[model samples]
Target: MRVGIYLDDQGRSLDVVVEAARDGAKAGFASAWLTQFAGWDALTALAVVGRDAPGIELGTAVVPTYPRHPLVLASQALTVQAAVGNRLTLGIGVSHRVIVEEQFGYSFDRPVDHLREYLSVLGPLLRGESVSHRGATLTAVGAVDAPGTKPPSLLIGALGPAMLRTAGELADGTVTTWTGPATLADHIVPTITRAARAAGRPDPRVVALTFVCVTSDADARRGWVAQRFAMVGQLPSYRAVFDREGVDGPGDTVILGDEASVERQIRRLASAGVTELVALPIGSAQEQATTTDLLVGLNTRAG
Candidate 1:
């Protein structure tokens, strides 16, 4: 199984993101992922990381499709891919209504249809082809060729049924967060796998994200984790995943313990069919570094 690190580029500076991504690559991580929040744009940060770490695979765990046009996004992704030598992965999503509607001043109604249309136009545009189509959500005419290689593999951040089906039919894979192996095996994996097979495509890659804090003390670990969970539990979409997994909260899914325990947790995810696992380290800098090192060491497992 491939292991990567997911960096929440919310409050961190661009330099910090680049430094961490460089550290991840130097430590032998397979990839470095950047997730969108309120601050830096995902592609922008990824471009910086791409320039800073030449060999590392850079990705956006998710960039919402509501605000930006698909062609614009595809062009930006292609640019980053060009800079990084085809080591860029694009993960796009229809974000929550609160953020899309309340934050971005966009309509949240019929997001799935919007995404379907976005991908229909996005695919060809990213592949250096002109796309002129009229869809329920997006319409475009002509395309400009960006100075880049072929398009990066497109992954959709999806949890719901319609989104999952769309991901399987159109995208290269699915990127998920706030989901444990139980929920993944029982719900997410089956849904996406079924969609891919039904579409006559090979099994789509399942990339799962989880938080980890490598600490020896139980209370310290639990306390550190509970705080993170408190924030995640407040998100309705994340709450559903926790509920499906029979987890009381984030602590139930977080990998917090000694090295042995954390390693076992990762193995569990692999058994559940997670092809790529992205670990988000939450805690003090030291603890985060420990978790990062542990993940780097696991790259040997791929050998």
Candidate 2:
């Protein structure tokens, strides 16, 4: 399976982010992805990174879909693709109700419907086709013109069955988090693969994102994950996945241990049908470095 690195762009300068991406590329990672949080703009920062870091793929772990119109997002994604030499993978999703409703002030009703409609408009625009869509949740009446650029591979952040079906039918694949290997093997991989086959599309990519820390102090590292990402386990979507995986909390999903143990868990993910593994290295600087080096070595072996 392909191995990638997820970079947290929170509280960091663009130059620092670019250097990180370059380092990932130099270390032989297949890709580098950034998330769309309250901090840096992921696509814009990736465009800057692409100027300095060549060869490696650049992607957004996700950009929230509710905030931007399909037209606007397509334009930005295509622009980034052009800037990145067609190395952009656009990962998008309908974020949680708390963020969409409480913060963005948009009603979070029938999110699956929203995702379906959003992709209907987004897919065509990314391919440089004019769209005149008028659906219940979204509408588009224009096209994005980005010459000399191919459509970046589109992935949806989908966990539930309906969302996975939609992602299989519409997008190239799904990007998932907080899900374990057993769940991916029994539920996620089969459901999405069946949907894609039924839709006459090729097998969809299953990109699994998880926190990893190579440490002898496994208990402390797990506790750090539990404390730092406590809110994630409480989120409804992730909670459902946790229940599906039969895990108690976000810390359980993390791959934390010595190098051998951590490598074994990652191999389990690969055996479970994950097309790619995106590692969010966690813990102290030394621990993070150890995790990255292990992942790089694994990636090299895979290649």
Task: Say which candidate scores most in TM-score.
Answer: 2
Q: What is the C-alpha lDDT of each candidate?
A: 0.84, 0.92
Q: Please, what are the lDDT tens digits per residue for candidate 1 over residues 1-303?
A: 899888776677889888889888888888999888778988888887888886878888898888888878877888888878899889999889888888899888888899889988888888899989887777778785886487888999998888889999888889998788888888888898999999998999999888887887656767667775587787777888888899877777778888898898888888888889998887788888888888878866764
Error of 1 at 50 (Å): 1.2
What tens digits encode model 2's per-residue C-alpha lDDT throughout 1-303?
Answer: 999998877888888899999999998899999989998999999999999999999888799999999999999999999998999999999999999999999989889999999998899999999999988887789888889989999999999899999999999999998899998999899989999999999999999999999998888888877888899988999999899889888888999899999999999999999999999898889999999999999998998
Question: In terms of TM-score, how similar is model 2 to the real structure?
Answer: 0.98
Name the weakest run of 10 consecutive residues (lDDT summed) in model 2: 220-229
Best prediction by lDDT: 2
Query: What stretches of model 2 exceed 4 Å from their correct place?
Result: none
Would you estimate the TM-scores of all the predictions? 0.94, 0.98
